[model samples]
Target: MFFAVIPAGGSGTRLWPLSRAGHPKFLHPLTGTDASLLQATVERVAPLASADRTMVVTGVAHVTAVARQLAGLPEENILVEPSPRDSCAAIALAAAVIAVREPDAVMGSFAADHLIVDPNRWVETVRQAIVGAEQGLLMTVGITPTRAETGYGYLQCGPLIDGGPLRRVEEFKEKPAADIAEAYVRSGRYLWNASMFVWRVDVFMAELARQQPELHAGVTAIAAAWNTPEREDVLGTVWPTLTKISVDYAVMEGAAEAGRVATVPGDFGWNDIGDFHTLGEVLPADSSGNVVLGGEGTEKPGALLWDTANLVVVPYSNRLVAALGVRDLIVVDTPDALMICPRDRAQDVKKLVDELKSRGEEGYV
Candidate 1:
């Protein structure tokens, strides 16, 4: 059986006010639709696997919220993280949990907020990754870069396998400068590291045991308590102590460094949807070069970008946001806060969050 894990434990502080601590980005309607990012992701995987086969991993703080967001999933499948550690611990815990009943099942772990327009192609790509995993290769789906995106990490494609369609991942490169990102794009040998992974529960757990024993041990205990009354209790005791590390830094990069990983080229209009600037590429812009998401019928919510272009405006609370004499800016409005920033500087939104922290504005974030 093919099982899926959706990790939804992110703060999404960059999209603050709209995306608060209690309600994460995945739970918000990021695409200007009624369904949240988490709901969309779950629906995308539904055609590939049943609801019973899908598991969502979120924090204790958002347990009720997550449960409400993904009501389609069975209550027993929602695994709550007692505390935030990182993707390494999250996926490790998922692998351990799924392995308990289906030791040989293929489990695909992915973030809950990614936007991939083509679900059919996504399922095809995931199916290929599962096949690769079944053959004892830890598989990752790499998106062919459509532009020189510096905000995302890239992977160098190694030589093709003798008979397989997959290729070895030469190296993982950090986000580079615009010029460097352009150069990497021109090289025709790199792919955006999308972080979607597929592997047998046994294979994943074994890899964790080899590369991250401490995390593996913690998850092992959590898995041992699966379907038991003490699962949540034990998780609360061990989760906070786990280190905060990405699965990329702790496992994938390490495995690639050891030369035992494979990549499946993905070309299904995939976007991690990490930042507001990326919304421009995902959403359809109007003839005036502005993306407005709001309104219902003739009086539907709408944003008026007068004398402005190349901006994304997501208006919440039925508020009309008007922009005049502005270009390349992001105007996001929520019930409690409003943010206006240049679209080019969208990558620095995290800095804004830090600045708020310095000013002791914790609640705003």
Candidate 2:
């Protein structure tokens, strides 16, 4: 049996106003489908791991919302974090807890905010990655780069082992300059690191101990008390002590350097749905290339797009929004705040959130 972990953190500040601390982007119906991004992720992995076996590691604040959305999952499967630590602690906790039940089970870590257009291809790709995990190598499902993406990190891959699809991960590159991103795409040896990983519980814990011993110990101790009356007490005390670092830095990178890492290229039409512009891709667009999301329909809430092509208007509020001669723009309207920027500036929306914090606009943020 394969256990799946969904780390549902991140406020998604880039998709802000619509995505807030209370309701992150993962909780919204960004894909135009009825299911929210988190719900879609759970459903996507349900074929491998049942609802009872799948676990969601999210902050205590989002626990209630996550539970409401994933009512099919067992209540205990929702692992609540006391505070924001990072992916290492979140994944480690789930891995250690599952190890207590089934030490040898293959566990896959998938993000809660990603979109996989082809579910069949996703399952098949994961099955391939699982095969690599059986060889005692850490495996990640690397999205085949479709374009020169400067926002996401890239993984340089080596020759395939045994003439199979699985290839050795040569290196993990951080988000690079535009020219470097284009070069990576042109080289054809890089894959976008989507943070999708599959490994056995025992193997993952062993690597966690080797790379991040303190985090491993902390999670192990907390997981030991998970079923007991001391679960909350132990977690509250030890979770904070776990080092605040990503699994990539604490484990995957070191594992890659040690030749203990491999990757399977997945061309499953994967998109992170990071910002409004990306979200527009998943949503339906009109003849004029204007995408409308939430609130009433395009005609009702009056998302009047006059000579507007390639505009993403999220009319989250009841108020009407009208755009005149706008092209390649994103307009997100919310009750508390409103944001308008060009499509190219979608990544810089996080900068706006930072500036808002600096300006003491905490309520809006």
Highest lDDT scorer = 2
TM-scores for the candidates:
0.91, 0.93
Report lDDT per candidate: 0.83, 0.90
Model 1, 1-365: lDDT tens per residue?
A: 98989999777776755677677788876765667789889988997689999999988898898898788889989988877788998888889988888889998888898888788999988888888889887889899999998889999889887765688888888888999999999999999998899888888788888999999998999889877999778888888888799999998888888786788899998876677877666877887778875534536456766788888887886777888988788888888788888888777788878888899988877
Q: What ranges in model 2 sit over 4 Å off?
A: 295-306
Error of 2 at 98 (Å): 0.5
Clashes of each: 5, 0
Q: Write the per-residue lDDT of candidate 2 for residues 1-365, one digit (tens) a residue.
A: 78999999998999998888789989987766668899999999988889888999999889999999999999999999999999999999999999998888889999999988898999999999999998888999999998898989999999999997999999999999999999999999999999999998899899989988888899999989999999989988998898999999889999899888899999988989888888888677899888987633333464777888999988777788998888999999888898999999898999999998999988878
**Which residue pairs in candidate 1 have backbone atoms (N, alpha carbon, C) closer than 3 angstroms, thus clashing?**
294-301, 295-300, 295-301, 296-300, 328-343
Off by over 4 Å in 1: 162-164, 177-180, 295-300, 304-308, 323-326
Q: How accurate is candidate 1 locally (lDDT)?
A: 0.83
